[model samples]
Target: MRTDLCGRLGSGDAGRAVTVCGWVDRRREHSEHLAFIDLRDHSGVLQCVVDGARDLRSEYVVRIIGTVTLRPEGTANPALATGEIELQDCEVELLSRAEPPPFPLDERTDVDETLRLRHRYVDLRKSRMQRNLRARAALNRAIRRAMDAQGFVEVETPMLIASTPEGARDFVVPSRKEPGSFYALPQSPQIFKQLTMVGGVDRYYQIARCLRDEDLRADRQFEFSQLDVEASFATRDDVLGFVTRAVAEATVAVAGHDPGTFDRMTWHDAMERYGSDKPDTRFGMELAELTPVFADTEARVFQAPCVKGICLMGGAETLPRSRVDELVATCQRWGAKGLAWMRVVAAGTGGSALDAGVAKFLSAAEGAAVIDALDASPGDMVFLVADERPLVRHVLGLLRLELGRPPVNDGRFNYLWVVDFPLFEALNAEGEPIPSHHPFTMPHEDDLPVLMSGQPLDGEALLGLRSQAYDLVLNGWELGSGSVRIHRRDIQQRIFEVLGIAPDDAQERFGFLLDAFRYGAPPHAGFAVGLDRLGALLVGEENIREVIAFPKTQSGADPLTDAPSPIADTHLQELGLRVLPPA
Candidate 1:
């Protein structure tokens, strides 16, 4: 007999005979003549009543043939959508019996994360996991709709390609057919997507899977998908506008609320105000520079010209001395020399204008100016970090996030365009200057001459040299980044040269793409949004793993399949490989 989903049985079908199939969520014998069982499937749950039944167990795969009956008035469960009606079973058939599960599938079960991952198939049966997965699917659909509507053609790029020694370390695979050679999993479809524009696909997109062998973070995974998109003959504004609307709309459709409009900020402004590029603006305790204030003061605090301060509104008089000390210690741990605190006391009532290690060092006027600059009032506490400018800003920025006060503009989805990132970061331990974003990023036209002149752009000058690049920041997190690519072969080669990439090495590594650029490549720009990260954030989970079906653990091991395992020696031999002894 055909059966219906348990969640499909409802009060609307009262008195109709129905066959429901699902796992028995809970079975209780309410005396010999009455029993109530909660049946559940992916759709939802339903209550089933057995007028005469003796034995039942949790998680039993059962089929119930019954008539839908409304729950008696006042017996309705307000917690469930199907609470108003239940199925009265006249016949029951046990389809499959289940052994006791390692952990209950109930949402309330508090199981260890490691244990849950090991038994992920069972864990996914829980309602929370089900919801996360459903939300992720919806998000994917929304992305496709948005991109397709924008006239983007979905494209697929190769997974195994020549490895380029740039950015993150690659996960390489030995080529059995071509011994002594390897194929690297794509870190991103970066070069290929740009090449698509070269091939004259004006607008291209993909729900592309990317792999990165980098240190894992809450938002990062070894293998993840990104909504990669590129457009020929489009400017940064065009790219940014499309992504902003698409991402905001997708988020609202899946998350049930519009996060609101985005705000644009320069990279410098973000750093100075938030001390982080990806600032979490859910709360405010904005960083304030005290460099100038310190430069003029005789106070020991002034001895450090790079000192910065952040005032916790209304926390001055109430914060305990011990807690203040603890905060200072926290800054030190992050590489600050020390933390300075000033408690704002009433002007006349104050025996001391400022209270802390540096209190005595400040004159009355200098102390008053410091308090006024921060807009301090009685009972407001200000914490200061005295260190290098960047370190001071970094420490204070973290502390601001920790306090979680002053309330960020949570109601608004702040999308920002952080433009003008330095084209090149300093050399690494190997004395190789690394691309701040990547080597292919084109330098600003004006700065091209300066860069080629062999004079480095200082921090301030670097701010003026806008690349054909922009980042989409939503509510303080960088959702994605894209750039108007360097399509001109000469420009691409110049950038490589400035980056110290040898001509032979550049040709060897990216010869295909360079060759493609030679044949009338259109000016193109694109951006990639981390689909997993975006979905997790929309679902309000801390990690992207919540949205992924089969995610690896911190060490990049798949517990479900025990992947990255040892292959047999025979298989290695077939691959023309030999296992090396441990170093």
Candidate 2:
């Protein structure tokens, strides 16, 4: 409906007649006969010199036929894309007018999220939202282009399928024709894409929709999208290479640079060094093992299975005793027995002088060893956790991140591939060790005998068996995970048996998948990247909701339309369902 977008016009278009249509972003009046109106559209805003009226208000949708002219010497808006030019000789036609918005649209200011969400249409009119959504579109296009170049065949997967109660709760749909039967929305396209590999679709990809009935967080939504992928006759490295190329292309489309080859680490090393499988390697006060240093200590508290410490650089004199106590409380809340600490004061007789009240508990030898172990300097303090190895690492890991957050907007990316995850992990209240990633993940080649022929599949035995699964982590967030599939029938069944899934139950749950294996399922592997989460990071948004157009609130309600409202009784009856009374 217009010759050019509002912001797309510039000095190059000078002397050319153009018809621009957009909302009136801002209007300033010099007199009753002259005014300046910043007309805005998706492209951006163009300043229009209106000679007729001062009645034009913000958000008045208008069409203007005018000649582009350079702005006067001192009036050019250098801050804008169309800053150097202005529209003159304008004939304005108001197509629509709007009431004052509930909140400012042109300038970014804090607005209540609930109010903004309820009027998301108005909120999206802002420049920030427009940029976020546009970046997402670019990201998807880049991913598709890269994958297409790599010989992947895009395929759509089923949304309505039988419930496979493996991970998060599913959003189920009542099967009206079948009475009590229901079709659950896919938590992922995991099974369907794997089946595609078996069906002879050598390479598959989809920008797939997924639903999970789980608690919402800042980076999560009830409905999300994943770059679902699968491939036949592919090794773990083969899939990783393809995924890396696609992700680099997408990130480049958004950030204008490749992230280079990601650094790799084993799951064992990740936990020990950073205390997280998806460690944020951007900054380092890397975890230090003090267990060896305190082995022969006289202090009873330091006689635990593990002693891990992190040197809090420049935190010794900065954190007051009260704050230190609060940090100790925080550690206890995270399941630590108690947080032990030592302030690394001036260099002393052997290592470093201790200052904290509890430092008296340690002998001279023990204190010196602690300082040396952590490489403590004058401006450092050592915080230690002593307990079972797992809990100690867990506490120190949490504390490390709390203390040393990465610098904001450092223009650095830390992409890590964490491999060699245990095939099974012990559960505190479980009957048997469960699959660490998924039941179908192939056991590592070296651990195949431990899985297939171990006398007893005890917790210890299960822990020794590693999986061929790998996770892609970026800036401490687990972007996604992929694994080589167990295409062998015997191996798949053995894994099910080890997880305590009875033969009958296994058939009832994954019968189709196991049956597919019987029909020559080729070896396959794939990974899925969270589009919302990844896009948010790429665009420098902390909350994933910023990248989503119509996101639900944390409570999972659509304020705009008041979705998840009550359904009509007639419709429920037609579907043979009844709403139960609230507990």
How well is each residue in 451-494 modelled by candidate 1, as lDDT tens digits?
66756554445444547666776555567878878877777776
Q: Clashing residue pairs in candidate 2, if any?
A: none
Per-model TM-score versus the true fold: 0.93, 0.97
Name the 10 consecutive residues with the lowest summed lDDT in model 2: 348-357
**lDDT of candidates 1 onward, in order:** 0.78, 0.89
Candidate 2 lDDT, 350-466, residue by residue in tens: 446777756999988778777777888876878989999989988888998899867524677778999989997765367688788899999999999877884676677777789
Reference-based lDDT, residue 109, model 2? 80
Give candidates' CA RMSD values in order. Answer: 2.8, 1.6
lDDT, residue 528, model 2: 93
Best by lDDT: 2
